[model samples]
Target chain A: MSEDLRERFPEAEWIDSHDQDVVRIAPDQLLEFGNVVHEAGFEVLADVTAVDWYRTRTPRFDVVVNLLSMQHRRRLRILVGVPDGDPVVPSLVPIWPGANFGEREVYDMFGITFDGHPDLTRILMPDDWEGYPLRKDFEVGAVPVQFKASHQVN
Target chain B: MTDKTIDDPEIEEVDLWVSGTEEAEWDVYSTDEGAQKMRLEETGARLTEQLGSVVTDDYDLDDIITEDERMIINMGPQHPSTHGVLRLQLELEGEMIRRSKCVIGYLHTGMEKTAETLTFLQGPTNVTRMDYLAPLHNELCFSLAVERLLDIEVPPRAEVIRILMTELNRIASHLVAMATNGMDIGALSIMTYGFREREQILAFFEKTTGLRLNHNYIRPGGVAADLPPGWRADVSDICDTITGRLTDYEDMLKENPIWVGRTRGVGVITAEECRAYGITGPTLRSAGVPWDLRKAFPYSGIENYEFEVPVGEHGDVYDRYRVRIEEIIQSVGIVRQAADAMPKGDFRIDDRKVTPPPRHRIDESMEALIHHFKIFTEGFRVPAGETYVAIESPRGELGCYLVADGTGKPWRMHTRAPSFYNLQALPIMMADSVVADTIATIASLDPVMGDVDR
Candidate 1:
């Protein structure tokens, strides 16, 4: 599967980070690459998450997807670079129906849009929530918690 | 609701008395309460304006219903059988469901957002609250992710202890599932019997970790402490007690005609549907997919343990029940073997950077004191990298993905909560089933809202 991913997209960088097969693909090729991986027997789309590399890297966000091959007992990590402005990636919902809530979550937390997601509404946050709470610059909004001493009886 | 609570004289709010001063009076509400209310209102207004365009144009109940005569109803944010705070919008044709949508985030606590702020040493403290029913699994997953990032090896005894503790927690969690499933299905006696056996396991937990639930015993490099004296006997007794009670559960529910009738053919989702929905644990196992993480992706040396991955032939509510029952027995066997072959060694790694010095050493040596103080204050740093660690949590394959940026705090932490994914199967399962069967479908999934909303 790793070799096929490399052959299909010559631009894809195969990385070996943290004992898992990590592949960095372009944002544009994400949907196509996912199709190839699915065809290569990676049946389980384990998780989909993003990391905010705002100041450290050019393409500010890294959208990470973990895939598991139950047949071969193997796993792979696919990372796609998404920039800050117009941060959009093709949706994997068409390929894997399981990415529905996960893509919605990435959209909710990081403000990264998945273009073809069926229902691209917020999953974890309220519909009216303003900022992406998981972004690096986004403040962890706090409410004042007043501590009042309890009274005692004799 | 407000009128009844305020009008009832028996429901008066408790009065407060200050302890320090002679006046001994305390006002529960702050004097600036009005200002606080105003700020909250402003925040609400701003949110409404930002999302106004999208919220109004979102999915309509009219779109899901096939005909104008079809009825649309809200199942619950507070429904008893929907499990914790899960609201379902059901479009029904008579009593049969046509299409359903699950509305979640009622219990959202932003645990992943919170993990970035806490140091690696404190990360487990936050994640453990995610799965309140199976907290040890949450802690173990988070700890394993951190340990993988740090590239540290745990002591042999600590690894064995972790397996032992997590297996016991799996049994306790499944018992809660059994209890709630029975209560949801109207078998009231099973609730009492299940909790009665679960309490014995919690007693063992308290004796070992000094807490009934959410024991933060497992740490990044190793466990927090060694097993207390006579823990072997305590665990042995717990296994024996629960193993005997397992048969009682079978007798009550296994062949009972009503139980069989309600669950046998209800809430059926084929193995293909389960895979597409990314469901795992017993729900996936009940569909005849033997894709358990313990065997597929062995972490923390689970390969050494000998156990069976119970699978069900028919992927119905009854099959899910049978799978959980068999799992409890297997957990008892694993615990017995672990107790008999408990290794003799340190409970934590010897690395001073991760694990603290001994209490006696801290008193005798000045350097040891400073090292202990520093380790507590500024935690050990991890190299810049990212990793994903998964374990066979009670619900499913609970996974933790961690990204470190060469600092004590994590760059980003995301938990692949099994319940969050498993709950997605609700709409699939609810389609074409009767309204009464919704309760059975939900109880079979056994999703904890903490795990879902985290």
Candidate 2:
């Protein structure tokens, strides 16, 4: 199946990660690639998430989508890289409505915008949230434990 | 509506037409005459204006009604029937619902962010809390992903133990679902019965995992420990007790007229809709798609077990209930089979790099002591790679996506929570239904808010 997809979309970079086939595509071709895979009988968009590689990798974010073909009982992972400056990818909601919440979550966590989503508002964060929490640069805010009696350490 | 005008000293005319239009201003009346004139000139202009010029004969009922008559209300971030912090925005025309939107994220605690700091061994402790009802499955999914990345296999005894514990967890989870669905639909007695049955299973879980809810027992290498002594007798007791009580539950609610009337035809989702929405587990099975991960894509030697996947034909609320009930029985059967075929060997993997040395070995050998110390303080480093592993939980397909950067701690760890995906189909199920049935439908979906918001 990976070989078939590789032949069809020659531009895609197929990386074999721990025996799982990961097809990395550019942001612009996401919708077309999604349509092709949908036509190929990947009925379910199982999950959508993004990983931020701050200062370590070139294109700062990789939006990962897991697709399941229930009829054939197969799974496929599709990755689209979004540059730090312009973190926008075409939404897969048209091909799979199940991608709606997953895409919203990716947007909420990584600050990547899905272009054609119906409602692109934050789903897992407050509407007035300041920054994306899941980004590598985002600080894991830690609160100091205040001792009741301000004791001095030796 | 007029009584509000008389109460306050700063009295103003109570415009019942646009009462709560303060927030969503788009629903308010447009004062622009040019736009109104354009709408008047084109007969289908109103349809085009609302729907982007795609004029069709089948117009929405909301399009015909004035905005004043159509009420939009928030069901909960607090209502009892909402299951947890789930809030629903319902667009209503009298008692019937025109549309509904599930407003989630009240319980988001940034667990995924926290998982990045935790090691592969500590990953289970975090993911286990995602689906509190089925914590073992969450741990199992995470452990499977970590094991996949590490390229190691657990002992045969460990695999059988995992299947045994997870199947039991499935039964306990379905019991809670049955209890809550009954409570929402006004069958209060069944709620008590369901919990009473589940208590027995939880007892068995407590005996094994130590904690009741967040049992961080299943780790990357294997389960935390071997099965407790006398587990066979306890398993037999639980199976026998649940089997007897299920018949009692069937007698009370299965053929009852009120139960049938309330659930028989409510919240219908077809097989195609289930696929499009990524619904799975009992909900998908209720739609008559017998696509179970344990059966289709067997993991952890589950294919070795003999069991049947029960499916429902109608895909209604009743069908979901029926599917869960039947699933509980099948889970019991699997548990019995696992206990019968329980293998005897080392519980966890033998790799010293991943699995810590046993307590006896640590006391005897200095090298074993250092290995144990190293495993705990710095944790084992996994080869840099990424993998996604999914297992069937009670609600749906619980998945774990793990990425390693050749460090003890994970680079990124995310759980594909089943409750999160299943909640996406709630609006489709609740559309065009009466307001009262909304509670029943949400209960039927069996979403755990911790799982949804995480």
lDDT of 1 at B452: 90
Highest-scoring model, DockQ: 2
**lDDT of candidate 2 vs native?**
0.86
Docking class of 1: acceptable
Q: Which residue runs of candidate 1 sit more than 4 Å off their true CA positions?
A: A142-154, B1-68
Cα lDDT tens digits, model 1, B243-343, are: 87778898999999999998998777677767766788999999898878988888777888899999998889999999999999989888888888789
For model 1, give the RMSD to the true fold: 10.8
Give lDDT: candidate 2, residue B94: 93
| Tens digits of per-residue lDDT for model 2, B274-321 | 888788989999989999999878999999988899999999999999
Clashing pairs in 2: B48-B53
For candidate 1 chain B, the 10 contiguous residues with the lowest summed lDDT are: B33-42
lDDT tens digits, residues A1-154, model 2?
6667888889999888877768999988899899999988999999999999899998999999999999888888999989999899999887887888899899889999999776676788877677899999888974346785787887
lDDT of 1: 0.84
For every model in order, the fraction of real contacts preserved is: 0.59, 0.70
